[model samples]
Target: MEKRNDPQLRLGEEFFNQPCLSLAKAFLGKVLVRRYADGTELRGRIVETEAYLGGEDRASHSAGGKRTERNTAMFMKPGTIYVFPIYGILLCMNVSSEGEGAAVLLRSLEPLRGQTLMRELRAARRKEGAPQLKDKDLSNGPAKLCQALNILRCFDRRDLASDPDMWMEREPDTNPAEPHDIVSAPRVGVESHGEWAEKPWRFYLRGNPCVSVVNKDAERQSGSVTDNVRSLTCAV
Candidate 1:
């Protein structure tokens, strides 16, 4: 087994030297550890991810050199966490990396440890008769996964390196997902991107309840739908 890395690991600069989405694809099944404000650690295994290469990639937030305050993290160093809101509802997290300016959006994860705590985070909603999270639903979507892991907008642009508060760990291979079972689809939203919108670039874990529902929650009236669920995608 790879030795347990220091919980307060400051990854060497070399970790940044890799193809962004390829690394993102390799992230599947890896565990992310969060030492919450309450001093309790929460853990989740990555089960879904979406790659967003900057600049030339039309569907990317930093495409066409259009830099917005929200997308500034794309230009940051590799391994940086880029957390953002979607439709003012869900929180999607991204790991900033790739060439000089690029990023890979982490679309979903399967909650592992501290699940009781995750369910607690949703207590208010459950009390209000909102959808109760089955063990699988806790971290299904980006924002939902954040909630399950107790990650807040405060984590936006937070340096995953040097921050003992949170870091991803290589844990035991719990339930290894397969590449064949994985699926890819164009990202949701940004129809204005034209051809980029038609590009199949999204990936998620097969049959993972934690994987986000593509064009789900119909009552909300959103983007085109797809059954494209998978565990990983590399924007190669």
Candidate 2:
């Protein structure tokens, strides 16, 4: 398929005006565009996502209809960017959906453009003497993706459809000669939430090397386990 060199088109608010699960599934294969202030652009194809059922999902911050300074964006109109920090340092990106508190978390991306810039940014974040980032590992996680794309706290609550710096674009073609198979599983973490953690809301491209974590066993586990594994892992 020929790369689309024309000006990218941003997904409209109507595109996000749907049920959270539907939006999450539809988001796969779409392209995320991040234009820096210097006219450079970072691009990636959406490969993984997780749906948050707003006021109904225990894992969602908007559960029980509680609104705070951090989650107010989730209550806004569809296509709003709901960015928040996890573990104090990592930033996660979500797109607000039709209903209050409904959002879809962007889990992983297949780097499509500006990989050199992404690598530079990722390397800069590492502690002195830390190993450099691998190409596939650059945007494999929510926070790592955000960092690679230069998305930060300033981007929280931005209107994705209208934002000049960032927006999501539709997949250029649905019938690429080689089509990607869609796969679904429960989201990573949130195992302590009992039944809510069992929701199979995570979706990704089957066999995509860019996919982050795909542990079906852990995905099915009801309790969080303690593992002494060392690994590095991002969003928007």
Best candidate (score: TM-score):
2
lDDT of 1 by residue, 59-147 (tens): 88788777788977778888888888877866778888767557877767787778888898867445576665688887776777777
Error of 1 at 60 (Å): 1.5
TM-score of each: 0.77, 0.85
Quick one: best lDDT, which candidate?
A: 2
lDDT of each: 0.69, 0.82
Question: How many steric overlaps does candidate 1 have?
Answer: 5
The TM-score between candidate 2 and the true structure equals: 0.85
- Residue pairs in candidate 2 whose N, alpha carbon or C atoms collide under 3 angstroms: 141-234, 142-234, 142-235, 143-234, 144-234, 145-234, 146-235
| Residue-by-residue lDDT tens digits, candidate 2, 78-105 | 8888899999888999999888799999
Per model, how many backbone clashes are there?
A: 5, 7
Q: The CA-based lDDT of model 2 is what? A: 0.82
